[model samples]
Target: MKIERYLTNKMLLLTSIFAPINLAAQERPNIIYILTDQQTATAMSCVGNTDIHTPNIDRLAQSGILFKNAYCAAPLSGPSRAAMFTGHFSHEIGMPSNGIPMPEDLRGLSLGMLMKNAGYDCVYGGKWHVHTPSIPNQTFGFRKLYEHNDSGLAEACSAYLDNNPHFPFFLVASFDNPHNICEFARQQNLPFAEIPMADLADCPGLPLNYERNPYDADVICYEKSLNYSAYPTSHYTADDWRRYRNAYFRLVEHVDMEIGKIVDAIDRNNLWENSVIIFTSDHGDGVGAHHWNQKSALYEEVVNVPLIIVLPDKKHAGAELPQLVNNGVDFFASVCQWGGVDLPDGLCGVSYASLAESGDPGRTHQAYIVTETLFDKGGNTRGWMLRTQRYKYILYDKGRYREQLFDMCRDRGEMRNLAVEHKYQETLNKHRKLLYEWMNYHHVKQIRTEVHLIPGF
Candidate 1:
């Protein structure tokens, strides 16, 4: 079952002639998927964020195709990770909130299970908050190396690679860090290491949209008002917000160091030419955007996570593609394709691997990507975001000004709300119809929404 060097979307051509110590060229490439918790898309230095130093994450971006438009399926740990491994939206899999168990039927068909059942040696090390705190062997199929802890997970993963077999391994090193920012915000002792803050003047300046906008979504205010423990920033001063930003960036750097360990482990085996490396986060932190300190908002900072993929042959190294990818489901698809496994029928994701092979830098695989969020509070508190080529449409189940539209290209900061602008009404309805059609196609009925059927659409 060795894989040949030449690969297509469907399968790897058959081959033979195995080598003992050094793996034969026909063997499938080892897939190293590294994940970090609560990391924003721009948190890495590779994406022009001067506030942080993420050399290890930056190195991956330098050596692979760094996708700028990668978004999470849901902006919470449990639901997002569930979508990622199951190749389905959170609601589709019956998990739209944190700590909810994944459906039993889908558990056996998870990404790890799919790859493991297909003959690849899969190892999962670190945080897996996809309903359960750790991946289950009875269903999820990956060999759990250890429970999630940043202190020794890196060394453990490195040692595993040193002791394991030579070729065709699927390894996951999921780290927990920047997530410690939660503890930092709570004013509790650091779970990892204490992030020392710089002087007030020396700290990174506040983002332009630091203050809540006049037309900010109403539910955002409602959610914050009720969740005091989560949104302590309600009492934060301008200087306090800057310090929070400083700590957030420092936490990002903390995780970056741990990531370097796994990358070094892969490099030690000389697997660069024979392994596929993918790095991303389950969800992104708010990083003090719009007076918000945590995730769950549909802001760009909350949903978009960094994605850097290093293919076995190292093709397209250093290329930053603008493809709009739902890193959750799309990642599930791409991994299956890269590992030479057939995708399960009815997955919403289209593999970026297939799109990348077309050799078109500007190729788009999705008309628009959706990010869903169901609050931890209660039922019917769900919200949805639809991000198209140049615009973002946000809708919530209950909230005044429940809809907001932003022209991402012109107003990347989302300073102005165009949902009320007369001239942009057509554009607004177009996106609303897109969501309406999407909900209908997916059989979503929880939103309690009714979009007028535009004749043309």
Candidate 2:
């Protein structure tokens, strides 16, 4: 469908003018969803990363429950955010890469629409990259607050909250910062703030897995060589990567400064006690891991993102949960459920609300989570990552080394490939079968046969 038809300024004005008055919006506790762009799970100081100081995001971690092993549904922006808002995988929605507009049907089921239908006043601001960088207020059931800049988005969110629109509001303050590291990688200027500077000795050092993985997929090198616009770091030196890491952390901190404003607004307006606040990113950046820079490769640095949830009355405050969460689907499902919306049948997203509200930190939510990516256009070279409790399995189509297995417990750096070892073939086969089952259940008709071609099974 021509999704741009819904995003025009005229349509936005129309949505704002005729939007229903929801002063009596459902009283099922307010929900505040704060999202940042391209922030890795470890970029926050709360995670013990000494290179950055994110006081605001760190405060969220302190006042909420943090999930350590959360994965994105996809590793790129357009597909990832599409999965997030629609509660579907990239392939399910035909949004496998950036710039692919979301189908019209999913728009009606998005978070904003779901909350609105549940009788909550919904408002969205900042980056919505569900194909385009702009959100269509009419279709998504949201009133656009302001533009996509981080500082302005924060100010707009604070002003909106301070004005006290109505009860049970679903507010999305999506900031586009840390994503400026994309420009930093290309040696271009960061649009929002001045890029921080540091000498080689002062900057953070290279990661331990700075070198390429042993027996890594060949498609990675081929795609990098083919797309220098994304991976300009293919030729970067150690000092260069340190400098890159320096700037990336600074950009992350830059966004945290704006997040502080939104958090302060929630407190200033006395919405803290009755609100469910969630903080996360659409996807993660490589941050110099395994010589990788931008996302789309199914590395740990790209898929593992931060998931922090602050429930009403600060339930389980300062606790860390290790449950496996796919924020793309689970996020949509959880927020909708919390807003008192009954989900339609045939949707399989399992919500993490129980885990967050329960007292069992030792609870196991899912055996594993799947993350799929489309690196090249037309799905020529796509990849599926199945992450289990202690192992990570990766499979890519059309690559010489098409499979990689890592014991995540021992090799979090992913420097070793157990898929190459005959002793681990049985374990590899089990993961393959799991992926096969997942694809079959998700109606993935295109690649079921491709998984059978890996030979060891």
Candidate 3:
């Protein structure tokens, strides 16, 4: 009798010990990260752009938390994506521009590898710009599913979800669109531009900030304009710019339909109760903003992007967060936290999961978000921008018009410059100090100038 009692006791103890592990496995949600190329934050109808319709992406926002002020670490594709996947800055990962492979040392730090180590099946499809030769490759630790094009990518992801794997999965559906706007602008074949200007009265108008910043003329913005004639904005009339905007909106709508398919697959497979969905873009495109057609400048149109996170069981549904989130870094941190994976040391981001769950607008980790650009077509026109809730400060490494400050609360268009005003000197000084402190904390070695430091008052 005693022998049987002892065996029973052993079984009970074992079950008690393993019960938590089983519970944790059940709680760990499957992740679906949908990335779009060259999409700005305002492209969605949910965000108040009445001109375009993005029902699928708006559906995610309707059922999830939307970050209203999210910025990428870099303005370019490869570098921005590298920052997002690795939870590091572009400089930290040694990817400052397109057409560069992620450094060999940091390959193990990718989000796919981290999730894989946590026992989740990781899969990737479409438009992986971080790899060399600008093609989909397996070196980033994801199982390459469909590498052909966006349509095939959507089909492959849907088919995978339909199969219903046993284990938790992390699926990435990266689409290329609105990026097609670049080709449209380059080809100068805007359909409406080809039509009679009188018939195009229904097209969108130029951006509110279409006129360039008056104080900044010889900076990186001007240099890029002169160097990349492929954009050809100088030759465009007001009607052509409007047609360009119209074409860009159409491309955004095109990708929205592709996203709808993936979301449909998730719902069809009954994964909503145990899956977390994320939708964002690598960077934004200039939809005729400031007479610009492409990214790489630090304008709000290029730097700010759309970030939507849908948690399982509708946790914090329909919440809008205004905290400045560095999408490049915060994305990996949030995913790691959700997957119950231990993040490595020296990661430069904080997980906003707590804030998302509680729906608190006051919650913020860092006071300001900084974006950097080391090189563009203009060649080594390094620049840094510091964005706070109410103001923006920009400093370029090489330009006569090196400093620009705008009170973003008053001037959302960023048309006015306050850096040269005597009254705003204190505000400018505070932001400059903040930028320097951030750079020092991150151990940023390049573009450190005495001018960035605060003067003794």
Candidate 4:
């Protein structure tokens, strides 16, 4: 047999390099993916929100695992969501803008496509933002789709579960409330509101940078950071911000109610023991954080998203994973891990599903988050950043290059910059190298960082 084993040798070598570490074959679990647009981590009662009641979402968390440090690669809806579907960065998928069609030549495949290929019945209920030329024909491989109907999406999803009793399903429940452009919050009260709130009702105090007007900080820090901008900020005010915040909370409450319906459906159908429920948002909104409204900045409000996963059988139920994780990308990998599906080669994510189940205190890993701002109406490049739990280092390049570093452990609000401080020089340099190395490794473009300003001039 060793006489002519040339191809066999290469095959063995490839297997050695590419074989998955977690080799345990698992039963296919019913997968439910729930994503709310522009909803921040603070909206959930499980994390620390007291303003609006989200008992259903809290129950989902209590019955599963909660991710305390999940961050979105881009804060915009279209790009963030596109990343979620394809498990590829927006830039990599040629979806840099909201209305842009995803290119055909892109080799990226979505979670639905993967699931469908694996023999699961794939379905999409509610928003499908990964628009493409084949869209009218194919909604990324979902055999059934109900796109952009945030109101009745939950009911449609429940109906699907009811209709298909025997077939396993990969269902996506995308809600459109909470994000600004639909004037979702404002239509409930305010109109075309664009100011950051000074305080969140019945919630935590406002961030030091929270603003009620558009200024350098708003443009550079907030707007430039998110992956999508649903609203225009030409006219904004304080009262407007208050009303908008109220409506935003109302939208979240509405979504929470819908979520309960789906959960109840699962319980009613006796599928609770075999289904896996995951709750997360595409990204966070500044709301009133840092004195600006919208996402597109590296502020905690824009990047940090709430993530919870409930696996059947009470496996790793009620565990809190504090380790940092980049959403969208890692989510696909986690799906494969928990669903017992085989993942194709060359995926850029690591599965953290075990952390939810093991409840092992020794589990900890370093994760890096990167955000780049492109040209707006005017031609200008924004900034790039890297964050760890203890230190947040930003490199800003607008017309010229500048740097800002914050010790999150000491000043979690990022009110003070330590890039120029000599004591933190070593830390700054270390993270800079890390960021640079990451950019090179991931094949992402390296851009200069920019200083953030408040919304009002």
Best by lDDT: 2
Give the whole-model CA lDDT for all candidates, comma-separated. 0.80, 0.82, 0.77, 0.64
Q: Please, what are the lDDT tens digits per residue for candidate 4 over residues 323-442?
A: 767777778777776655665655565566655556664564544556543433333444556777677776544432256677777866667777657887788777777666655445
lDDT of 1 at 132: 69
lDDT of candidate 1 at residue 284, scale 0 to 100: 91
> In model 2, what lDDT does residue 176 have?
87
C-alpha RMSD of candidate 3? 9.7
Clashing pairs in 2: none
Candidate 3 C-alpha lDDT tens digits along 1-457 = 2435534553453233222222122578898999988899988999899878899999899889999989988888888888888888888766787777877777787888888888898888887887542334556768888773665678889999999774688888888777878768777543211223334677877788987887763665566665654466677888898888888888888888888999999888877778888999988987888887788778889888999988776667889988888888878877887788776777766566555766777764456788887656666677788999989888776666577898877887778889878999889888877776666666676534544432331
Model 3 quality (TM-score) = 0.89
**What TM-score fits each model?**
0.91, 0.91, 0.89, 0.81
Q: Candidate 2 on 176-208: residue-level lDDT in tens? A: 878999888898887887875677898998899
- CA shift of 64, model 4, Å: 1.0
Residue 329 shift from truth in candidate 4, angstroms? 0.9
Across residues 54-162, which tens digit of lDDT does each residue of candidate 1 receive?
9999889888888888899999899899888999998886888887888888877899889988888888888888766766654587888878778888988899888
Best by TM-score: 2
lDDT of 2 at 380: 55
- For model 3, what is the alpha-carbon lDDT of residue 118? 88
Ranking by lDDT: 2, 1, 3, 4
Q: Which ranges of candidate 2 are over 4 A from the true structure?
A: 1-27, 376-379, 447-457
